[model samples]
Target chain A: MISIIIMNKTAADIFDEYLAAKGLRQTNQRRQILDAFISVKSHCTIADLYDVLKKKDPSIGFATVHRNLRLLCEAGLAQEIKIGSGKARFELTFGQSHHDHLICLKCGKFIEVFDMQIERLQEKLAEANDFLPRKHKLEIYGYCRQCR
Target chain B: MISIIIMNKTAADIFDEYLAAKGLRQTNQRRQILDAFISVKSHCTIADLYDVLKKKDPSIGFATVHRNLRLLCEAGLAQEIKIGSGKARFELTFGQSHHDHLICLKCGKFIEVFDMQIERLQEKLAEANDFLPRKHKLEIYGYCRQCR
Candidate 1:
């Protein structure tokens, strides 16, 4: 629990540094959005984030939340996950290791997963094709245990 | 060369069946679009496909091309790949075995790749999480040899 708090603090520091580098202001609203985003443990759509923000501060408009989410993505503090035809979901990236997702089609659950073997093989596959690999996105979609 | 032609023909047949099942007319324009789409070996944006279609048939509008591409996705003949902040690219899916992609960030080139070990491990990971996996998408982005 203490580690999680430290992680969130580290994420906020990273975002602040990113904003400073871009000459962007660190507004109270942006801080609020980031806090709400970090508090949620699952991948969330913009609407999902907006809903949470709306409850806490009714004055915050949807568009502001949307723009801030994109800023967060640009800062590398968050990453967007697009699944099938669904709305793009943003998941926290800062202070997190590289991992893929197992998304539940029925309940919208996201299971973060990582495998050293899969990672090595991906690198090998890219190397075989003469590519200097940078990053990868792997998402497996299906029904979770209860949903199935 | 002969095998590629056979594959394109099978794709067209499958698309025709899909259009018929949806109670949609198999228009000449859509056929032309499909042909252009399948002929291109790399993943292409709508603008890329539109450029080819417009050169061949000036009457085909961009909206028609965009609509048809979405239809192709729904029909399982193509899949949309969103990489970074770039425009989404559509690649042919029909008459092809399951494979991932190695995308060149510099030149926008795509290399089709498959590995049995990665596939098996993905299934194992999903099963371990109690997920009934339906499908997966893995895209590795980097610089190809020439670009590097």
Candidate 2:
């Protein structure tokens, strides 16, 4: 169990290493924003974030929260999702393991899912089109079980 | 070849059918806009569209163009692509079936590529999560061959 845990990388480790490579100082602001993201595990718009961060630390300005989120997105530490909503939401990005999103239109909830078959199919289709596919995001919009 | 072409759904035919279904008149402006889309072979922004449509018919209004485009999107005759570019682009939904996009950041050129593998994988993932996936769009950002 210890060996397995050691081999696995936590979201924090990935983010810290990314910052180190980019010569970006692990600032308290960044740490706070990152912690907020991990704690609020759902699609969160910038405005939603500003409101939440303001409650936790009144000293943190809206601009600070916004800037940190953008930085996280640019550094590949997070994903900006547009789930048919006008505003963009951010989520933590895990290495090569990427999953598609199932968005509930009614409740505005997002559920993550992964399918190997679809991934392989995309590769084959890309090959036929002479396209060197790199990264792809698949988001499906629908209602959840409770909503349905 | 003619018979086969008739058997398969043409883009314009699909557009006309959708328009009729929605009780939208096949107006000169709408026809012109649809023709402009069919004439071009790539993703287009509303500004890009206004440029083309204005040449064909100088009297067309931007509002009409915008309204018709929205109608087309709602009718499923066209697709609305939102890249991180801030402004959204529209493309006539072709009979080529559903596919993803490869957007060249440097040149601002976009290419459509189909990947069945990725689609299947997403479906499986959605099922596992008990999330009913409805639709998906993948936009990959990178430099194209020409731009590279």
Candidate 3:
């Protein structure tokens, strides 16, 4: 069992409160899965997370990971990323800042970048359209420098 | 069989040239599928298109529509939109100007908007990050007025 310390010292408490607010029970498996997810630096899909946890516990299933991911997003502990209209991937958001992605089409590489001007433009655009803009995702897919 | 005339009068010719370039045979089914796709005003998923075409031509199967969709994308007659990391939807791009979307999560509604400012901001951000932006998508997800 890896004692994964999160960026927020209250990560375990956050998870516990999330489960409590949702009237759900906290299990050993959920703690283990979040630990593994926080350990990885890049984005992860359910299959990727399953592979990581199964090696440690040998009992984690894909569906549990998938359900937990949705919960984590709802709890503001993680964020979902759109890598085209294909396989879904997520990043840990606890103690992490928000940014958009530049994904390489040829090599499946992701580079995270933050730009204040872009964020302002999005808010302005949403206001113009009468969109409440609870959440949004912006992804640029093309050949990265290495692939180019 | 709807004789769909698009912005480009020579759409079939374009398909023919694409097929020839790829060493693929231009078939009647491809033409019919293109006809159905071009006729729709909004975005369409494979199942959405199949349902639309199956009513017109029961002979067309799901796999055939799916395969031709890829060819249409490759041929540059269509553009794919990622509604989050969910199902793939496409729109006819020939002679249509570029735009982004505001999606209603509660009701599954898509509202397209064109903004010059958004486009300019994206180019600037990509340049700042040294990312050559080939293509980009921005989708704002929230409740529409009706759903709200």
Candidate 4:
């Protein structure tokens, strides 16, 4: 819990820095959205995040949440993940190590996972193709243990 | 070239089977769209595919192209890939071995690659977490050799 709080603080600071770099103001609504996003700690669609935000402050409009989430992505504090043809989901990226996702097709649950061997092999594959790899996304779609 | 033609023929057969199973009539428009999709041989956005299609048959409307692409996906002959927050792109999946993508961030080129060892590791990872893994997508974004 302490670590998560620390990470959230850092995430806010990073967002502030990003805003400053882009000459964007640090608005109250953006802060609230960011706080709500960090608190969720799971893959959240725009609707999912808006529900959480609406509970705290009814004035927070859906468009506000939508736009701010895109800003957060541009700030490198969040990532947009698309599963199949569904609506996109946003997951916090700041202070998180590189990981893949195991998504439950039935329940829409996301299991963040990492494997060293897989990472190494990916690096080797990139080198073989002479690609200067930047990042990667791996999503395995199926049933989770509970669903199975 | 001959092999590609054979694979395309099989893809059309599979789509015909799928449509029959679903009680959907095989329309001439759907057949034209599928042929255009199979001939592209690269990741293409809806707009890209529509452009190729319009050149062959100028009467083909964008909405028709879009709807049939969705049908192609449902028929399991195509896959949709989303890179970042941009437009969705479709790729051929039939008659191909399981593979991942190396996408060039600069030129938007896609290199389909498969590594047996990486595939093995993914299976192990899914089993470790008690996941009943189905299909998986791995996309690495980078500067390709030419871009580099």
| Candidate 2 lDDT by residue in tens digits, A16-128 | 88889989888878877877876775578888877777887889988888888888887777877765538778876644358777888788777777666676766666555
**Local error of candidate 4 at residue A28 (angstroms):** 2.6
Error in Å for residue B9 of model 3: 4.1
Q: Candidate 3, residues A1-148: lDDT per residue as tens digits? A: 3344565556677888889998999898888878888786658888898899899888778899899888888888888875755677889787777888888888888988777877787777777777777878888877777886
True-vs-predicted CA distance for residue A28, candidate 2, Å: 4.1
* Residues B52-78, model 1: lDDT tens digits: 999889989999999999999999989
Q: Give the per-residue lDDT of model 3 (tens digit) for B8-121.
A: 556677788899998999787898888888776568899999998899789988999999998988998888776665678889876577888888888889988778877887
* Model 2, position A108: C-alpha lDDT score: 74
Query: How do these models rank on DockQ, best leading?
Result: 4, 1, 3, 2
- Superpose all Cα atoms of candidate 4 onto the true structure and report the RMSD in Å to 1 decimal: 3.1
Clashes of 1: 0
Poorest lDDT segment (10 consecutive residues) of candidate 1 chain A: A1-10
Q: Global lDDT for candidate 2?
A: 0.72
Local distance difference test, candidate 3: 0.80
Question: After best superposition, candidate 2 residue A62: deviation in angstroms?
Answer: 1.5
Tens-place lDDT digits, model 2, residues B5-31: 335766567778887887878888988
Query: Candidate 3 clashing pairs?
Result: none
Scanning candidate 2 chain B in windows of ten residues, the lowest lDDT window is B1-10
